[model samples]
Target: MLAYFGPRGTFTEQAARGFATPQQELVPFDTVPAALTATRRGETEAACVPVENSVEGAVPATMDALTEGEPLVAVAEAVLPVRFSVLRRPGGGPVRTVASHPHALAQVRHWLAEHLPDAEVVATTSTSAAARAVLNGDFDAAVSAPVAVRHYPLEVMATDVADVRDAKTRFLLFRRPGPLPEPTGHDRTSVVCTAADRVGALADLLAELALRGINLTRIESRPTKDRLGEYRFYIDLDGHAAEPRVGDALAGLHRHCQHIRFLGSYPKAEPGGVPAGNDAFVSAAGWVADIREGRGA
Candidate 1:
């Protein structure tokens, strides 16, 4: 199995390490779109990308990639806990600027308010890049994951520094056009559908799900990139499409919705397994082997 992620030390990469088999081949990209492109072009078999964060809410880029990419089915889901660590110069002083990826900066807004209230926030493209900037002494501090401090050779002044407790980010593994392995008792189904710009079209879609007693775990709306009033709905709900109620709701949704896309119905995170924030890095030896050999399942 080939896997793709944001960068070497971002939370997305950290999450991918945990889900991949020892033989999985991992690839890195600066943007989620680039990663999706790599997978779509058959340069890689599967791509891993972040979907949402507990603190920062939805990741718009991931949503956009899913909506635009060709028929990539989600195979597995994982939630990695986000813990921002404060990285500073060797000799700490009155730090004036805080740097981080825009999304990570949003996740730690409360912490920034409480700690560096006067610091200017600069948006970097990725957390790993922010940590590198701080390491080069270009920024006073960086808000990034603990893994970044080690990757970029930076010092951590604060651990779990994010303002919120128990913040988690969900990641999805995407693969194209294949019969996925059978369900393993724990899974989720994700779908994207465009509701009529008209009022009540969205309500009618939800009512269909409600009528079937299907519980929604997440619901998010994205601009359809059309006129200002048009929108698309992305949904994550309990159960798999192979199940009856879920399959029925999707069928009903397709009849009424303008556009319908089923991203995937795949296994969820392993219960009582490794918690999201504390993933250990083994050599990529096994992971690299798995992706190249086609044992991704």
Candidate 2:
């Protein structure tokens, strides 16, 4: 079974469905951390949670949650196009109040201001939760996933509502540390690291990747909360840890950073990129091993 951050009719659920095998059952949690905790506790095989959104940046709760408590590793990822639909109960009426998740509302802020300027907006825990609130007569309308209208008996007031036409959200499936997935040529490795509080520290970290020829796909820093200026960086690189280059880069990171955590290396959702390679590192290791042995260098 798999656990997902959901109340049903959420994009997380949609992404989770894509990850679930035919034999897998999905259990929904009220929050991302709860779902991950379920996996950590062995209640479920894994948990699905949103990690990043093209429009709003990384999900702080998820980024912070992964670094706290027992470590969890993301084994898979899915990206879903973000398009919202505003739903309300039957019978067209003036929308006096609108509700949805903060992220969802932010995506449609401009549209709401133009179409429903007089409508007061409220925030809910999830888009589906907002639809439920509207069903329960708590709000006049809800900005929700298109699937939410089917789950709840609501009509869409507006469709294809978004401030950005191509916004997307990336979700990840996490499980307790164990054997990692095999390298898929086109894969991503993620890690969190704390650099020394000094000049050139961050640049030094990037320099390791640059020297290794490892592509740095994405990087985000979150406050460490232990100190005023200390922060933990969440980095995504285009390669699997099993690859020679990525392994060398990770080794360099360990030597340079005060602390580092390997999240996991997983296949890309949509694979299409240069394959990661490091034949030089492998040959060099073989050469050093030969010399260390009774054999000649």
lDDT digits (tens) for residues 1-297 of candidate 2? 899887898888888888999999989888778998999999999998889872223378888888887889989989988988899999947899999988889889999999999999999978888999999999999998877876799988888898889888899999999999998788999999987677888899999999888888899977788766566899999999888888889999999887899999998997577454578889888988888995765
Please list all clashing residue pairs in model 1, or write none if there are none.
1-290, 1-291, 22-286, 22-287, 23-286, 23-287, 23-290, 24-287, 24-291
lDDT of all predictions, in order shown? Answer: 0.77, 0.87
Show the lowest summed lDDT stretch of 10 residues, model 2. Answer: 53-62
Please write out the lDDT profile of model 1 over residues 1-297, one tens digit for every residue: 565566677787777777688888777877778888888888988888888863223368778888885878898888877788888877767889999888788878988998889999998877778888887878989888776765776667788876567778888888886886466556678899987788788899888887767778789887789656777999887666766566778898899888888999887774622122111212244566787899763
TM-scores across all candidates?
Answer: 0.76, 0.87
Lowest-lDDT window of 10 residues in candidate 1? 273-282
Top of the candidates by lDDT: 2
- Kindly give the number of clashing pairs for every candidate: 9, 0
lDDT of 2 at 264: 93
Compute the lDDT of residue 64 as modeled in candidate 2: 83
